[model samples]
Target chain A: MKILLCTDGSSYTARALDLGVRVARKAASAVDILVVAKRDREEKARQMAEKAAADLETAGIPVAIHRRSGQMTEEVVLQAQAASYDLVIIGGRERRGVMRLLLGSPALRVTEHVPASVLVVKGQARDLKQVLVCSSGGPTSERTVRFAGRLARALGASVILLHVMSQLPLTKSAVLDDLEASAEELIRRGSPEGVHLGRMLDLLATEGRTGHAVIRRGLVRDEILAESREGQYDLIVIGAHITPGLNARLVEDLSAAILLTANRPVLVVR
Target chain B: MRRRQGKRLNWRKPGLALSGFLLFTLALGLMKGGAGGLTPLLRNHLEVTNAADSMGFGWLMAYLVLSGSPVAAAAVALLSASVLSYLQAFTMIAGSRLGACLVVLLIGCIYILRGHEHWTALTAGILSLLLTGSIQLAALPMGLLILGRGWLDGLSIPALEGLAAGINWGLEPLIGPLAAFLPGWALFVAGVGLVTLSFRLFDRALPQMRLERTDLGQIPRLVYRPEVMFLMGLAITLLTMSVSISVGILVPLSARGYMRRENIIPYILGANISTLADTLIAAALLGDPRAVTVVVTHIVCAAIISLLLILLAYRPYERAISNALAWIARRRNNFALFLGVIFVIPVVLILL
Candidate 1:
């Protein structure tokens, strides 16, 4: 497998670099460190790439370093599309009003168009400990599940599946019964989500990965963040959902929101 | 969702399916024409002294074939031919809808017997029948009153009338021979068969429901928004032209384990509304402008009740339906008894 690491040279970028090195060494993947800068800083960018590459190679991992002077998003998209790189790793930065709008993070857009798996490291995690695979019960989560499984197997870590249900119709506890019916009619019934969860559990079993699932009936992002922080997970694995139709904007926004709010490393598998 | 392209047929042109639709329309038109000759014989056998009796006949008719559209179409055709009163036809169509929903529940019965979870398999089918039956039954009284007042005469679609006209005239070469040679009942049967065949072909022509993209892979989540699922159901039914196919698609998807019981009702509500399109074709073929009026009446009545449910009490409605189905599916005895009761009531309605 070949992996590309795109960085803007920040502390978070260093953390991403470390994670990338560890993954490449463990999985025997070839690594490329790419630094994109405007023409004036092109030479500086080359020095940064070569230095990062030297450190990775000294750790006994194969490495290639390249520096390009162009737009960051365009360069990575072109490179990722032009080649069948197994995974692309990028570090996310906290952006304010104008920077966020004009430069509007490339990771969000890249996940939308690119077919390759992406891992966006949000925080500094030296090693993989506990992993959280966020699921919306959609098909795109298949890649996330498998990727998490491989990492867990490789690192001997545990996996947790987190599902959040949104209560928009009525209060989650509310039920409608006939006002006129006798007491004999009132028997307790629960939602049939168990059958669906059974299937999801089967998906994990088929992958030869054992996992425990936690369900929360609340806002999707809030619940996921709460689980990640409470679990003190080292990494969060979620699908880079390019949601279809009207669901696209909402899902993409949620993905971005989760990426920004998460205090731990986030791996967005496509 | 990226529409996964198929290997063979360009769903783009759909030339063959379009031809199948034309023939299907022609078949329905022929059925209308043939039904005209069988009016006396049908009136002799299917005639009922009261509305309840006619409804029972409708139930029996739909039960015979496990489809509601043809039976509803037949009722409208009989109305156009003056073989049955508007009240009789309205009640009968309601009964046919009630009976049509049986197909899903019946399929669920097989699932239960095969050891699948009752809540997963039967909920969709039961909710489909219950929703359609309640709305249509509720719509019947107002429908009869509206028919008596003749309020819908101005509401006819000139374009639809013309389309029906063009079809009948164009297909005379084919229909005339069959009409001349075949007995009336046979032609009616043949028309029903062709209508079913047309629907089957149309289903073949639809974009396959890729279960992988359905998102049920992660959770059997219900669409909390009733309006969205309602429109989705309407759109899917319009495309398939069969309520069973619209609802049946959920079965295989649910078997893969992701559809919620709450999602079933509104989808059935939408499907039940558009499932009347084929009946409208049957009514149009009769050439009585009033027959088209009757078809519209069916559409309006259903749409009104459905929209009313969606706007006013959709949540409670979904909860009640879900709770009731769960109660019924909770035990083998309850399942058997409910099955016996549903079957016995329609038979008793006919006997009464």
Candidate 2:
């Protein structure tokens, strides 16, 4: 896997660089560090990129560094789109004022716009261990599950697939015997959610890893965050919003919400 | 063969729709004629002299009928009769919406009685009430500001005058005899019943809520953007002309595992704004331009507040709602406290 690590010479980006190096070393992935600076800050940008690259090289990971002078988010997005990197890692910053209220921080914008999967490093940096893969059971989640399985296999981490059952039939008269069933029971009955869970587990098994499926019924994002908190997972993996067409903005992007709110690192797969 | 074909093509929906329209028109006429009688009761007995009191009155009235649109229509009739001021009418309509969410709660209670998990059965209703209560209440100050500035005061629809005149032409003969025989208060009581009946007929005319799980297969099982859900809520309510019906469908959708708490918030927000379609029609029927403006104020304020919440502070707002849900679900006492507070606040408003 090829990984792109983004930096801006900040302490936050330094933490992301360190986390990126560890991840690349564990997964045996090649790394490229891209640092974007303001028009006159090219020297600082080059220094940050080289430092991040040297850290990766010292870990015995194949590393390359690139420096660009432009808008940080635009530059990072351009590089990610240009390359065939499987993942783009960046550090999240606490935004304030109009930026926090209207547009999110540059890191968040890049995460939302980038084509590759984004791993937004926030809060305390930690090694990949317990992984929480949030599955909406949509077709796109198959890719998220497979990608998470591969990442887990590389990191030798335990995997937990969480499916939140938040929908209820509109009327009481409709038979809800199946809805009341547990995840285990649903799997036994071959219910759609159950079958989806079974298929995801099988995919993980193909990656030479075993994963447990857990079901929670509540708000989708809340349940995912709650499960991540309860399990103390090192990384939370979710699928990018796949609301195609003009009405795409009408759909909530759960991955973006997770990135904005989750205290730990979040890996959003496209 | 022609007769058989005629019998085969269903006319029940169209027939019910015509009946509902006639009933709605009749209800509007009755309420307008009798609204003056409500003034004394409203001022002396209910003591709904202030905007807050009128809002409380509307809220309690919705609780009495288990719906809000009728209460909102009542506000318009009262406004037309000079019984309630424009601001009072606006707040009353807002309060009716707060009370309207109870219908969803009642549906959730039925689910619980039928042996569904407490949170699973109640989440849609709880979130519906929460979203409606929060967004409407937050919009109240802004609505008041808009009214104060007289922003929509001059807003008028000249086309409605012809419609109102046509309605008068059709209903004058029926109302004249009733006006002579019935007391004003009695006419108002009868009007309320007719309005409720009209709503029932309209609901019957609506497409049946018999959606199969397979029918929703194309709808992705993901959290929709608040704006998308908001528009959906608006569109559905506009079609059904009842927030209760729109939110009621959400319960079944949620029960079927096709909706989430996050998806329903904006949906409920949009539903609340458009649920006033009946009230808006009532305003037009009364030929009171200001009545139309009052309802328009609520709609405009609500749309602005909902959009701002979705765009700017959605994460924090969502977190707050989720935390409130957790608190309610954490203990039986918490739920009881919530229910008690919702009931008590309206009474307090009336007393104030």
Candidate 3:
């Protein structure tokens, strides 16, 4: 897999690079580092990209660095689309006002527009023990859940599947029953084949009463944010695919909303 | 202590009162001008009977509904407007019943403010409905006369007919040689330009005329319950539909007004008005319509829905209805589910 790391030469970018290197090492994927600079600052951007690329290469992670000019967010998105990279990793900036507006936060715009999944890293690295997957029982969500289950297993984390049953005039008893049936199906489908599967099923049957399912009702984004805040999970996995330009804008807008609101680091896996 | 209290009182904010006055003045001016300009245009080309014209009052009611929740307002408005067109085929009295209920509920709301020293304002709303209703009833004779004379041209007709005769009979003979010299295309361009200019001017000059911000801070404390919101949305849509249907059936004579060529304008206007129900319901259920800017958003969305509907006609609404129904199907067991499956399915299957 080709992993794209979007950098702006900030300290956050450096940390995100470190995290990307670690993730690439684990996933056995190649890292493609992309730096977007102002049109006039081509030399500066090239220098930063080169240094980061050399450092990652030295750390035993294969690196391919690319630099371009223009509005940072738009350029990065265009590059990601052009390259067709599997995933885009970017640093979350803490800048405010004009500087922040001009550079355009990569984490904000890329998450929304990019067809590939995005990983927005913030602050220090910690063990990812609990993975929460938001599911709507759609194909996109099923894919997300499967990916999350693998990541949880790798990290020795227990998976918590949450389904936000929006209170849309359904009786409480009916909604609860639907949630239970869905939870059972998810657990059954998510388990691997063979000896591991039997043990997983036994574990689920026992803890399924407590650890497995969570159902909340409200707006989609709000409910997701609320669950994250309450759970304080280390990473959030979301799905994405390359969308048309106009649809990208709509997704871009939604991504910006999530970034501004969500507290935890989001690992968007395609 | 008394002197200090007096000084503190003197320092109390002054700008709020000033701003309020300015906003009220601006709102009044826009309302007057908009009513004046659109009324004449609607009358001339559409030739809706006066009773049907009173349906415009429903527009004001819709504006109230939307003022509270624009997003939901826009959705409801789009659905209601599209449904209204079909409902008109049944009977004008049925349509009038639907239209009148909306108007009455909205106009009736003003009465709630009667005890708050705004009794006169409430009275004005009641009086406006009465006056408008009377005028519309009175205009029936004039509409009949025009129809009898074959002057009532439907939307399917072209704007121009017998240009040479019009120039000779209606222009040159009536207004003399100056009318013939007037560039018709230039005049049309100028008229469009003037309308655009007025709209811009009104938008710029009017302050309070702007959409009221949903007070979101109160959402958490109020009806954040999803069930409540769903019910409220359902109730408002049903009530609006029922009222529109009844008006169409009961006031058979007012059919043309409900189905005028320029019906899109009121339909668009009603889109904003219908949202007020959601906001009001939100306020009642949740006690805060703030977190859910559904109404405000819907109002903004109405412009998009209106443009699309005007351009695409039934196609856009059909897609929206289907999409909404599909969403309901996925979520399953909701009110929309029962309505879509139980109500729509049986009816459609029986018809098929």
Candidate with better DockQ, 1 vs 2: 2
What value does DockQ give for candidate 3?
Answer: 0.01
- The per-prediction CA RMSD against the true structure, in angstroms, equals 13.3, 4.2, 24.4
Clashes of each: 3, 18, 57
Interface RMSD for candidates 1 onward, in order:
11.0, 3.9, 19.9
Q: What is each model's TM-score for chain A? A: 0.79, 0.91, 0.67
Model 1 regions lying over 4 Å from their true place: A1-270, B1-8, B11-13, B113-120, B209-219, B248-255
lDDT of 1 by residue, B85-117 (tens): 777777888888888978767776666576644
- Largest TM-score belongs to which candidate? 2
Label model 1 with its docking quality class: incorrect
Q: Considering summed lDDT, which 10 consecutive residues are worst modelled in model 2 chain A?
A: A168-177
Give the candidate order by descending lDDT: 2, 1, 3
For model 2, residues B1-352, the per-residue Cα lDDT tens digits are 9988776545878899889988988998899899888778899998999999988888889888998988899899889899999889999998898888777778777777777755545655677778888988898999999999898896666787678889789999999899889988889889989999999999988976643353332333556667777787898889899876776655544435445557666777788888888888888878889999998888888889888888888878987887787677667788778888889988999999
lDDT of 2 by residue, A59-116 (tens): 7888877877677788889998888889998884678687787876776778777888
lDDT of 1 by residue, A119-213 (tens): 77766675776888887666766667877777677666778887665422111112212111121221112233344344555677777778877
TM-score for candidate 2: 0.84
lDDT of 3 at A175: 17
lDDT of 3 by residue, B264-343 (tens): 12222333334244233322222122212223332233334433443455333423333343344353244334334422
**Model 3: iRMSD?**
19.9
lDDT of 2: 0.81
